[model samples]
Target: MRKIQLGTTDTMITDYCLGTMTWGNQTPEADAHRQMDMALAAGINIVDTAEMYPVNPVRAETVGNTETILGNWNRANPARRGDYILATKITGKNAAFVRMGEDITAASFTAALDASLARLGTEYIDIYQMHWPNRGSYHFRQNWGYDPSAQVKSVTLAHMEEILDAADRMIKAGKMRYFALSNDTVWGVAQWMRLSEERGLPRVISLQNEYSLLCRLYDTDFAELAVNEQLTLLAYSPLAAGLLTGKYQNGAIPEGSRMAGNGDLGGRKSPRVFDAVAAYLDLAQKHGIDPVHMALAFTVQRPFPVSTIFGATTSAQLTRILDGLDVTLSGDILDEIDAIHRAHPLPY
Candidate 1:
């Protein structure tokens, strides 16, 4: 229930953000509403969604359904809209269904935001993010063969300039309060920061990258950048897609689980991931703390500003995660976690 500053912006967001990627697909609208009510009651103010949500099977037909559900709730309870900090993203290239697979340009950015506003039934989005870079990212299982060389330097800079211009225009138009990045690399964040400074456009307020106990990609360069650049880390998949929760241990995927919907969990499933999860689970049990609490708490305890984005298909799951908010780990427990990390550095 604690609130943290969102970058240099005047907005203060809850330490835990409610993620809505599963709202319309793995979770129904009624369940989404119930979860929203529960999350609001718990003092969770940030609710993050994307233009292309209801993910798991991310279909063209189901695109924007999650925002629609949120929009419905906003319309029904107009007074409640001001109670939450809402964020959404504009899809990047490679999604064939969005903008017919065109890379995000100034025009495409405007189009995406207009449509997103319509879907969310909001006059202005609190935080508008670039879902991913047009040059692609190292996240989402692409780190194995990911290469940034495919994009020309001039092209990338031009894209950044154009996007920043669009973001500035949106800010002036009252369509968005601030802009952020998602699934970005350290260099990408630097480019955004540099471009914003040069053009006097909206600065990059946050970077929503994947970070969890099993996935520590942000611990290296990104951590330093986050601190120095004053960019808050809106860490998505903070539970490593539920791996850190220890529910998928020993090849046990419960029915209707995310793994069941997408067999590989968007590239999270690997031979060594289980070992990493087991180590964290063992550390939690040794300290007599729930693994979910340890995992969520670990993220907020990082050196930089972090708001862990967590989602659940059921209210019970939400309650369990919310209960872990106040559970802080001790120094000895952190030392043990570090020892485990030393033994198995990069399990996935």
Candidate 2:
């Protein structure tokens, strides 16, 4: 329920952001609207979505349905359009189904922004993000096999400059208020910062990346960048794909759950993952805290300021997470959590 300054922008947003990646796929329109209403009433003012969403299966048919759902909500609740900060992403390089999966160019940027605006039925987006860098990223469990040898620095910089130029034009045109990044690396962020300063382009206000008790990659160099650069972290998957909720433990996959649809939860089903989840669940029990709240609260309490993005496939799940928004871990609990991290680092 706390509000924080959105990077260097004049705008302020809630520490919790409602994620709509499952809106049209796992959740229905009426349920999605109810979730939004609940979130706004709970003082959560940010809603995060993307052009390629409803992503468990990520079928081409459901690609942009998430935004359409949000657009419908905005249209129905015209008086509350400005009540929340609307943030969405432009899918990058690999989504061939998305406009032939063309890379982000000046023309593509313009076109994508226009199309997104039309779909959301909004005059402007509060925060527009590049879903991933053209050069690729090491997130999404890709670190083990990630290779950067093929990336040319000169070519990457040229592309970044061009995209930033287009972003500046979009900002001037009032299509979006702020620009951010997702699934980016330290080097990529550095280049964007340097280019924006030198070229008077739009500066990145935030970085949305996967972060949770199971994934602590952000605590490394990215944490330093976040602190020094004042780049607030909009942490997605704060529950570690729902593993941290303790429901996936001991092979208890509930029907209609994320794992039920995508069996492995995107390569998250490993022997070590269950072990790690068990440890966290036990820790939560020892402290008498709900595992879901414990996981989300821990993320928002990171050294660098963070806004934890949470998604739900059902209204019950959304209500459970929202009910615990006020839960804060104590110093003892945090210290014990650090000890657990040391013992079970990178279990997934």
Candidate 3:
């Protein structure tokens, strides 16, 4: 694992980031701690979690358990906090369990930041991000019915200012170092950049979005914004929720898997998705590469600066992925991948 410069910040972070969305649900606390240990040993320097995590169910009961599990690790590894970067998100609207589904205001922002700090048992966070735009997003398989016609520009601008002020306060108070966005659009990102530049608040450094060979939504406009603005892309679900791993292929849903519980795979499962997966799987087999490695390496080796935020529920999965971090895809493979994309783009 190699490190990269984090945006315009002086800090350097690993090209890989550990995701803990299933830490407290399918994975036990001991296993979660062990995964954290394994991540550090493997040279992965960043761990990302959220206030509403461990979420196969996404119920009220386990909303904050993932953060608590991570906090438990911190309590035991008291001296190793500085070894890895920490990032977490504030849940946006529709999660009634979190602040009764309220939008993010300056007051709500401060409250959520304070709560996240308490749950992680950390004084400060390296990156604090909005899980999604309060207005809504085309992410999470919602692109088919996506509509932004109802969003009021004046309201959104004021909201951005308020949130930026909230971020400014948190940074000044030593609660967080950077602010970021997740599941946002190009316009949303542009506003943050403009507001930060005009108001001189904390600069937004990164954007965490779903970017995989299976999902190339960010390749055009978002890629342009990231390159010109010096914003790093934190790619989530680079494996397409384990689709690219080929485990879920041939209509076989492994027990205790995400698809087993939520058969839809967050609405990503369809006839076309399976067809796309087969194409990529065939490509991997032809190249004599593991699909997981090929999937991850493709994202990390993108033309844009990106760090893949991948997660595993068990030790075997974790180690297998760690072992393949060095597998670099050649020019032929990339060209083949692009050809495959052209054949079956956004199948889901």
TM per candidate comes to 0.98, 0.99, 0.99
Reference-based TM-score, model 1? 0.98
How would you encode candidate 1's per-residue C-alpha lDDT over 33-127 as one tens digit per residue?
A: 98989899989999999999989899999999999999988888888999999999999989998879899999999999999999998899999
Better of 1 and 2 by lDDT: 2
Tens-place lDDT digits, model 2, residues 70-176: 99999898899899999999999889879888888889878888888988989999899999998898987899999999999999999999989888988999998
- Can you tell me which runs of candidate 3 are displaced by over 4 Å? none
lDDT string for model 3 (115-231, tens) is: 999999889999999999999999999999999999999999999999999999999999999999999999999999999999899888999999999999999998898888888
* Per-model root-mean-square deviation over C-alphas: 1.0, 0.8, 0.7
Q: lDDT of each model, Cα atoms only? A: 0.90, 0.91, 0.92
Error at 136, model 1, angstroms? 1.0
Ranking by lDDT: 3, 2, 1
The prediction achieving the highest lDDT against the true structure is 3
